[model samples]
Target: MKPGILVISHGSREAAWVKLVDDAVIAAAASPCLSDIPIVSSFLEIIEGRLIQDGIDELERQGVTDMYVVPFFISSGSTHVDEIGQAFGLPWLTDLEGDLGTFRVSANVRYGLPIDDDPEIAELLAANIAELSTEPEKEALLLIGHGSKEKMFHERWQEGLLKLGERLRALGGYKRAEYAMLLPDQAAAKLAEMQAANPGEAVIVVPLFLSRGYFTNHVIPTRLTGLEYRYNGKAMLPNQAIERWLERQMLEGLQRLNEK
Candidate 1:
């Protein structure tokens, strides 16, 4: 069976954001670990023409009979991941109503998961906040994510973020690592709570977004107004580790395809 890889991510209107994903995909494709299969990056929405359907059609045109759809999202708890999987004939597991309909597909799909608690992700984040953190023992990391109001989705975010926080703490030897969601607007409250709970520790605010966009640039900073904290606003993009993670996922998919 002819197989290909498709990385699906939440699209942003920011050119830099889109370019980061594309650059990672290109780097992943260039890896020697992967076979010479057609691979592309597609978005769930926002970007015109490069939508999920367009990606499917492009790969199908290349005579790809099987595909692995990898969720490039930060967390699998994202509702978009569930809906997009549903569009590819997976079960609609979420309680939220999805506006995305089924797409035309003739090839067999091998759905891949998101970057929840990958060690590479932990390393990437630790590296990202290395500059902001002076003393790991006296610092606390507060990861901010775009949380959901829905129970199931919110839980998913919590599960992933919690595990990720543990990993970061273990890797960086930080005093504490916690997360806050933007949807429920918990950034400010969480920071204050953390500060009160762990006095004398410097709080480092890290945004759990794929790229440095409006959320990382403006929303996060605005939410934490008047709060004393360290922030670099560096996102999970333009990192070699992420490129390796992408390649590793696609490589594992290739192995799975071969096993079948």
Candidate 2:
């Protein structure tokens, strides 16, 4: 049973974004668990030939029979996860339809979940904001995510963020952890609410994105135009935790395949 790993993320036109994912893949491939296993980093869209189908084709060409398709997304709530799953003939994580179309998947596909509420991810978030957090115990961590209007997806986003917040709050010893989504444009209101609710707490805005890109740079800040919160817009990339997460996914996939 030849096995391979395909780590897919929502692509960006920016070279840095793609490079981060590829670099993480390189980091993950060094793990002892993945020794001699072929691993490819693919994108949901953009980045041309490195798209999901292209990655799958590359893996199959390498004679991989049981391929582990890892969804390197921030939340299980993402519509892209559903679309990607649908594309690979797996059950959708949401009720939404997939527009990504079907892929010519010849390998035994085993789809993995997203990075939702992981303990290490919570650490990554805490570490990302460590510089901005002068007094963590007196600060309110406001997590900002690209949310969904769809009921199921939105609920899933909140669920994951809620758990992640709990973990981060404990990890950082912060006063509290709050969340807002750029979608439906709630960053300003959430910021206002967090400040009001916490009174003397310092609100620290953290973008719950995979990497630093358009959302973290432009969209998130624009949504908080008149807000009074501390923000540096650091995202979850160029960090070693992500490589550990990727390696975990591949290991779990191999374990599942062996069980079968």
Candidate 3:
């Protein structure tokens, strides 16, 4: 039988967002090379059924010797990815043991690169901005991300988005593009200022988030609703590029397991 593929995400309380990720993975699996393989997903938090270990156990039960666990993360730099790896105690491909106990049902897991890493991601954000902005010259785009308290992860996210903003500015369409965090202070106030400066023009509030969970669906919209401007709520959707990248990583993980 073909190896089973498990796409693991941090999971979310938002059922619709979870369905979005599920749909994206299913669509990707339709590719001829991956069609025969069984592909499933589970969350680390929220929503139950197939946790990380459950995915492993299911694959093992099926007599499937090869398994691929791909974290649908936007960054390899996140602590969640590191923690997940440590929890599994599965060394990456380079250090696999050849014994059946090790090889019989070896898991090949790869944490994904962040969405900000993709060049096309900027384009996607820009497209959303265009849809929100009625008057480009007077409007501003505020990209809000879930910033981490951990210095490294937070910095990486900040840097990545900043670079994305720079690229968008180079394209020379939007008048102003800036990033903000959910953590820290005065996010709503900052957005208000942008609206104040723009006067009559619209303000596009884009959440640089993967899924529409508590933060994206509830908190963000609630906060922005009070703000003065044309609030065009365009949350990010799962796209083909993200799915393809995830599948490629899964395939690579499988290949590495075979070598061991």
Candidate 4:
């Protein structure tokens, strides 16, 4: 029986955005190492059809003896990732062994490892910044993320941004690289502040989100216009390194399951 691979993500209401993630995952699965694996994707919330259990059921039907679930989130500190794992009855302390009555299916699930952690991710961000900014000297890189009310997750995002900024600074090409949160303060206001700090310099607002949705498509563009700032906007979609990261996590999960 072929081992099943499930790419799990926080589902979005926006169809186009969801399709973009799906397409990215499909492309990732097409990697030479994972091309033959029976890979499927499902959402933890918001979207329909293949919820976590639905994906599990299909995999079982296909006679899959083992499964690997990789969460497509930017932060490993998210509460949703923990809650989703709990919903599947796999607590943080327990091993990945699922009892399905007639056919026992062993499973392993891993949560977020921020894109910024990947070495290639910094290059991707820099490329995006270069594409958006015509004047490297006058332009500033603004990384915008959805902050959490909870301090833990919020701090995680902040730290991730700082690390990424450091990497960019080490590259030493951009005028400045800074980060801001959408939850704590309005993105528009933040952008305005950034523009004011560096007059005549363009800002490239990169949504530090895994997938584009309400924030990337509507809120960001609207806010840029409202703030009366010259800006460039783009969704932080997955790149080649992200796929390798996912695969590595899957392999690690499989190793843990084998040990058990």
**Residue range 1-260, candidate 2, lDDT tens digits:** 89988999989999999899889989989988788898988999988999999999999999999898899999988888889999999887656788988999888888899999999888898888889888887888888899888888999999998999889899989888888877667888988887787677789888899889999999988878876888898899989999899889989988987777
Ranking by lDDT: 1, 2, 4, 3
Local distance difference test values of all predictions, in order = 0.89, 0.88, 0.65, 0.65
Over 52-93, each residue of candidate 1 has an lDDT whose tens digit, in order, gives 999999999999998999999888788888899888989877
TM-score per candidate, in order?
0.96, 0.96, 0.76, 0.78
* Best candidate, lDDT: 1
Give the number of colliding residue pairs in candidate 3. 3
Which regions of candidate 1 deviate over 4 angstroms? none
lDDT of 3 by residue, 67-106 (tens): 6677777555455665666566654332322221322235
lDDT measured at residue 259 in model 1 versus the true structure, 0 to 100: 79
Score candidate 2 by TM-score against the native.
0.96
Query: Looking at candidate 1, what is the lDDT of residue 116?
Result: 86
Evaluate residue 159 in candidate 3 and report its C-alpha lDDT on the 0 to 100 scale.
83
Model 3: what TM-score? 0.76
Candidate 4 lDDT tens digits, 168-189: 6455376877877776765777
